[model samples]
Target: MTLQTSLDDDAAWQAVLARDRHFDGRFVTGVLSTGIYCRPSCPARHPARANVRFFVDGAAARAAGLRACRRCLPDDVARDERAVLDAIAAIRGSDEPLALAALATQSGYSPAHFQRLFTRNTGLSPAAYARALRSERAHTALSAADRVTDAVYDAGYSGPSRFYAAMKGRTGMEPSVWRRGGEGMTIHWAVMPCSLGDLLVAVTAKGVCRLSFNETAADLAKRFPNATLHAATAGTSDMFNRALAGVEAPATAAQVPIDVRGTAFQELVWKALSAIPPGETRSYAQIAASIGRPKAVRAVGSACGANQVAVLIPCHRAMRTDGTLGGYAYGLDIKSALLDKERKA
Candidate 1:
């Protein structure tokens, strides 16, 4: 089927007229009458079909000199602002025992009120968001070859026990095991071109592990600086080929292997992302609260941003608190398309 076939052109145009957040970023509707293109979910009046054209991506619309719609601020939405600020705050205040009550107090709201408002605005509470931020920092540090203990302490985890517990809860494996980097285990991976650019699929002995895009082999190496990576052509490994095929289509009962290495919190966030069913979405704040940290809305946004794995981990399922489509490492266009596809499914 064609890309446009997937879009309910008439309904999409109506959604544009209504400025539906649900359709935001899904596709661009170009108005031949006004010489402008807009997100399908843009809130604008309907124009005649003769005056309407559609593009699969923003770049195509922009390349034609049709500006984005002003209503949805198609070009300006990003989830990173919250994530960045939260990360900075976590880094600066690592020595303190940051709590929900403390964050609520600082925000001038009671913990309950703060929780509601924060989740509404950023999709995560204060504490959970902060924990994710700390976890990300710890993961980056460890990925850079820092000792596990040193990275944990540096990330502000109070002690080894707490860090270990958090790690196991999130990753279903120990940090040491993750660091070993699929040593004796075999990982199956495939490279393919995709809508967003190039795609990379890596699976371990357990489940679908890593799906990344727009990165060269060199880039992948840098991302997993400490892990050993190998090139796998078709026919080299049945498991690897199976993983590639499975990711392209839905399947059941296949245990794909994963060689994931990250701080406890990031692993947790990623695991949560994976749990999101295809065709469903969760706000970033909801993800944070689900993990028992309700104060880390911003941090949850960061974890979503930091995610390296694509569809299989389902970072695309995350949305802004106001139901806005947010940033994706690949691009907002891809994020919108992925969500749209899932919604249709």
Candidate 2:
């Protein structure tokens, strides 16, 4: 059945009453009686179907002013262990520049065995996963105003020429041409101080784009060491004020402006990540398959690791096959908190 069918409202409500583990994070149930929303596996008393409302994400529910149930703590779950490890190993190894056969032999597994085990464990073969990771890192570096050569080298490529050629083959553009400033772009952002720590939102001209947490001027300096950041405090524009308000309350929606710069492959991966809804997840292999590169699982994981924007891009939603919480650029604790918050939301 299709994903939407799997989340049939009637069936999902029934699952909520039954506290089905499989339905965890699939959707949320808002109880009209208590004025709270909970996960399907919540231990709280089941509410009448007539009093329940379903939502795809906590932000939407919160936007409706419905408080999350304290008992279920739906928003506190993290990535499954299997998915985490698979994505992490894939990302870590992506920078290795070694041939797959030699790499497999060194790891004491046949290439075929390695491929199967990797896919089974992380949902993607090693090579594809590695490439995605490298591309993502390259993108993140480039977004911060780093030179193309610097981004390529930092992502473990030998040189800019090779990186440019590979990026062109994958995305049809030279990296330098993509780094235009936030010129005419308008981004929406939100800031929230929830269980996951402080949050920041940075939206693109098109939609919600960047989301970060517990960031300071120093942190921003570190992330974009070269860029100039402006603070908007006049409440003149809805976008700027929304972002500032999100920082104050931690869950409000805010729109701002963004200047994204990255290689074509990296851009593709980021776009795929942006499509993932909150509270749901996809494996690295699944992301690769979605992008029409079934063999690029490892690369997908790398791209996720390299993501600079946090929740807005939703890279944390990617996991390994065995249900493990994977490595996160911001740290495993933050990852765990973000996952838990969504699950419980």
Candidate 3:
């Protein structure tokens, strides 16, 4: 795909400041002042934004009369992302769980460093990623299988007891019920037009769980295909209406309660995001420091991206250290509008 198709200049600039590895190999940053091109996540000092240019690839950068920065070596796209990708490839490629030491050795880094590197890039430590992967595999197996025992074994769990215990926390339901795709519970959802766009609010007996934009009732049903989904009843409308109002005016959205799910670290990052007062913002680096994992800035970004509850969780409040608006799930136009609304409020 073309560079413009992959990411616009504004989005690419965010990657440059964050040193976001996801954008590595997708584009090269040409520093006009230095006459050099570098990887998006190059650690070298950043040139002035006006002096920076983006090229589709190394050839384009060279054609523009720029040499690659010796430090980041933009010409070698594969190696720029090799360290983290190698670790990820090894973990995903293996059926059985690979130990930290083994993965570290394969990546040519010491165990501790490898763990940090892996977590910084993927947002979860190696072990945590393994657990999540296992849980996902189990969930998929459960969804596709007719029998609970079949899923349990297929998920790689040694026994039913362990599998049920692990799945309980992940699905917040019994193994049998979860395997049935939340068959026992009723999910009420509504798609209401708000200032942003079509806002979909879905809730269970617990609380408001999902608040998404540009989605239809069908989208919500697909999220929990096993659950009995219906339009919001009068009893449930008030709670969700308030949430919709919150989306219209974020400064007033706080008191609305939400029931959401995420990993422990993601919860921490979400909490930090929620604490960012209506009009203000925080950098990904700052959020990482607040969570006591100062180096997990990328992971913090991942948590923001993974946020299911949009305005209530306030992922848009997080930005890059350079004070530019970073990536946003719902489009930067919406992100900018939300921030603008909050600041005015």
- Highest lDDT model number: 3
Tell me the TM-score of each prediction against the true structure.
0.47, 0.42, 0.58
Give the better candidate number (2 or 3) by lDDT.
3
Instruction: State the displacement of the C-alpha of residue 105, model 1, in Å, after optimal TM-score superposition.
Output: 28
Candidate 2 or 1, higher lDDT = 1
- The per-residue C-alpha lDDT of model 2 at residue 77 equals 28
Mind giving the per-residue lDDT tens digits that candidate 3 earns over 51-102? 9888888888888898988997777655424766666667667878889999
Predicted candidate 1 versus true structure: per-residue lDDT over 69-147, tens digit per residue: 7775555323223433453365346675567676665655577865665543333456556666666665665666557
Off by over 4 Å in 1: 1-189, 194-197, 203-209, 233-236, 250-255
Candidate 2 lDDT by residue in tens digits, 198-299 = 766554433333457776545554554333444433342465455444333323321333344444455557666666555566667656755445568788
The deviation in Å at residue 333 for candidate 3 is: 10
The TM-score-based order of candidates, best leading, equals 3, 1, 2
Q: What is the lDDT of residue 297 in candidate 2?
A: 78
